[model samples]
Target: MTNPDDPRSLELVETELPQLRDGEVLVKVQAAGVNRGDLLQARGYYPPPPGESEIIGLECAGVIEDPGTTGRRKGEAVGCLMAGGGYAEYVAVPEGQLMPIPEGYSPTETAAIVEVACTVWSNLGMLADVRPGQTVLIHGGAGGIGTFAIQLCRELGATVAVTAGSAEKLETCRELGADILINYREQDFSEELKGKCDVILDIMGAKYLQQNLRALNEDGQLIIIGLQGGVKAEINLGALLPRRLTVRGTTLRARSLEGKAEIVRSAVENVWPMLADGRISHHIHATFPLAEAAAAHELLDSGAVTGKIVLEV
Candidate 1:
């Protein structure tokens, strides 16, 4: 039998505390966001990039535990979209990726907001150039990223359309400013939304690709941020040419520290204020103690969470 003192499984092991480098800040994690990438990593199908620690979480909010060659005062609360290791009691992030927790936001609330906001802003705000008056179609509209994307797109003056699995989830999306809601289980969304959108924020991949491209208006952008559906498929450039549609995909965990830090900088300058002033709120579905992270992951894996699942430390 494996000794509890030397647990070998992903969730049970307790290793020596990790260290921080120059330009890094050690966070005493209060809560961590459980993302899809964490699930993949725990299964050993994905790993943090080179130079990143082999821990499972991607983002967290916490108090500063140690400062390494940086000027951040210890005990100040901060939030970070990290490369890995956020599931622990402590995680180190480069100072550049750190931001003061949004004013009036507690660590748990900030934990729910940081990753989805960073992800949406990076892909929708930066890459796709989603602008006001453009219509955006978002899939998985009830998930963490979708909820944030719906609000941010609306805040940007775009008309928003979304597809969730149920009427209840659709109502939540609509409450968050979705102009149109499609229940995928009951209707053909792209068929219902024909020629209606100027941008598409897609989470389901190849399965929706063809119809999504058909749904875009001229000069439209389709940015795929998740592949909940299978990834491989053929692309029809012919369909894209006349509409000038842009189909692109991105993953946050694979990005470089510098790239993610740039995302953090932009989010703090832009999206953070919306959160601080109550124009945007983190959709926290539930919280569990740090030791219950496996259950949290199972919850996320179950597809029942309407928003983020957080592990409180």
Candidate 2:
């Protein structure tokens, strides 16, 4: 449970195992992925959806300990995309949110990839329908989501551009097939790529709103998945109408069970093959024991991490 007075206070305490509802299974978690959202929850900025666990984790890889009403056998390894409760040793997951572990990936690796795979695929594939020969820009390209998105856009035969705060981070993005790299600390990404981007996967919200609009080409799409900079930006309606641009903001955690299930299914059908065939890979920047989750969150919050962080249970 989060402390009202001290948002960053995290402690391990004994709690009863979650009771499973219909079509849900109990998972013995092996590892859980750490995301920016988890840090927000820790700081009391983000909270779990109504009727969901208040535990601070969004995704995990584990074995089914109790299959509940689902037909799956116990002890099957699976990766779960969750609304909450992944930090615990055991979590109740709707069967539809469970994904088969990709071939050749361990529980740790599976944990690293599940949320990112589902998130990127759902936005880039389902929402934008990014096509080949397009120019895609991804902000925060050194982070887990950006790195994964770089490879996916490349696999789709699009030119990839990315922005990071440091040269080293930009280099990492380049190695992952990024065609253009802009160091946001030193360069103006909007000025550098004006009217060139066909699709932009943005994490910075209000701070980059106008700049992102300036960077897009006609019929361009700007998909906002995070608000690290801020929220509540003023948009120019005139610019959007003349350019035929689209700005969409989405959060996966608040989606319904059926919605998340569809994303999981589509991610498995499309992105899973890329993982299996080695067209894309999971990058785990660091790992910590569940007891050191505070340290893990601190490291990720530092903005120096190049990829995903995992908390092993």
Candidate 3:
């Protein structure tokens, strides 16, 4: 892909594949996921970490060309959560990052699963330790992570509350089993949810910090994964102390290979079966061909997408 001065910098050009490194496998990409991070990278704001490919993609599902030492043979369909380089016709990924496509999913569906699944598993499941009967608040209810988080939290026995900018999006969240729907545009979420949130999955960083704190129940955990609002915020230790609240932040793109590998392992062992058995589902908003990546980015920027946008390779 081309890195240019414009937002529409994505270009399809012929490139040669490299020889596989240790624990890496060559995949013939079928479909890949488009994410907000990819858009930031397009605007020259987010670059790949050292040793990662400079291409702009985070997840993909494809057939294995060379499985390397992963114990799986060639030609098996697998999905991967990548550091970068899922926007191309092929990608070289660590074997541990690849999960066999869940039994009933298509390539496009499988492509959308890995990144969001691992993110929710790492933050909500592992870090926050969300429990049965807990009240969880998920911001951005219609987005890729929000939709999945709603379903996963519901399936795991948590009562879910979600915030979205529109009614249609909130309705989608309702289908995913979200119990409380707060239209952020029309409602003050902090007022609607005061003292009701046991766990809050937040993306609007500084903008919602105080409100999120106000909404949290005692011993609440707030995990901030995106900075859509602002980057800086003030934490009221006085309020946090009385509630015993915990606030944490994380990003998947910057994690070490070992950390990502462990997340992938846990998802494969735990979440993959849910997907295979129809307990979990992938939600796609739209798809564009590899050459139409610029248009995909345009749609993402419009902020109208209710779920993930995919690119067919």
- Find the candidate with the highest TM-score and give its number: 2
Error of 1 at 250 (Å): 1.4
How far residue 122's Cα lies from its native spot in candidate 2, in Å, is: 0.5
Task: Give the Å shift of residue 224 in candidate 3.
Answer: 0.4
Kindly list the per-residue Cα lDDT of model 2 for residues 1-313, writing each as its tens digit: 3464443467777789999999999999999999999888887889899999988899999999999999989999999999999888999999999999999999999999999999999999899998899999999999999999999999999999999999899999999999999999999999999999999999999999999999999999999999998998898899999999999999999999999999999999999999999999999999999888878887998888999999999
TM-score of 2: 0.98
For each candidate in the order shown, give its overall lDDT on alpha carbons.
0.85, 0.94, 0.90
- TM-score list, all predictions: 0.95, 0.98, 0.96
Tens-digit per-residue lDDT, 192-272, candidate 3:
999999999998899999999999999998899999999998877999998899999999989998999999998888788
Model 2: residues >4 Å from true position, as ranges? 1-8
Report backbone clashes per prediction: 0, 0, 0
For model 2, where is the 10-residue window of minimal lDDT? Answer: 1-10
Q: State the displacement of the C-alpha of residue 84, model 2, in Å, after optimal TM-score superposition.
A: 0.4
| lDDT (tens digit, per residue) of candidate 1 on 1-313 | 0222221234546777888788898899998988877776776767789989887788999898888789889998899888898989889898888987888988999899888999999888888888888888989999999999999999989989999999889999999999988999999987988888888888889888888988888888888887878788798898888878888878888887788889999999989899988888889899999887777877888889898899898
Question: Candidate 2 clash total?
Answer: 0
Candidate 1 stretches with Cα past 4 Å from truth are 1-10
